[model samples]
Target: MGSGVGMGMGWMWLFWVLLILGVVLLAVVAVRAFGGGVTRSDRGDGRMSQERSRARQVLDERYARGEITTEEYRERLSALGEDR
Candidate 1:
């Protein structure tokens, strides 16, 4: 009787642990679904700024490497709508 009682209590503890884990998992899913799961790249202007900064860096590197002439560099920068 004592052994059987201990076994039952062990299973009961396992059941409660599993139940709590399942609830937490459900809450995370719900939050991601209904809490506006917007990522960094989806923030519009911020992402555009990051892209423009990257473009400017690449352009500067190319110019530094003498891959393009000053005229071409100025044209590309103007096309990108950036003065500097």
Candidate 2:
């Protein structure tokens, strides 16, 4: 009878732990679904900035390597709307 009681207590403890974990998981999902827990940089604006920076870096590399003429580089840079 003592062993049975111990087993029941152990199962109850496991159930409580699992219930808490499940509740935490649900809260995380709800926050993400509602866009409540994310910052601005985690959205599309940061991605756009990254892409523009990458493009400018590649353009600078190509210009340094003499793969493009100064005139062509200026034209492309202007097209990318980046300042000199």
* TM-score (all chains, Cα) for each model: 0.46, 0.47
Cα lDDT of model 2 by residue, 46-69, tens digit: 897788889999999999999999
lDDT against the true structure, per candidate, is: 0.88, 0.87
Writing each residue's lDDT as its tens digit, candidate 1 over 25-81 gives: 999999989998867766877877788889999999999999999999999999889
What residue runs in model 1 are displaced by over 4 Å at the alpha carbon?
A: 1-45
- Minimum summed lDDT over a 10-residue window in model 1 is located at 1-10
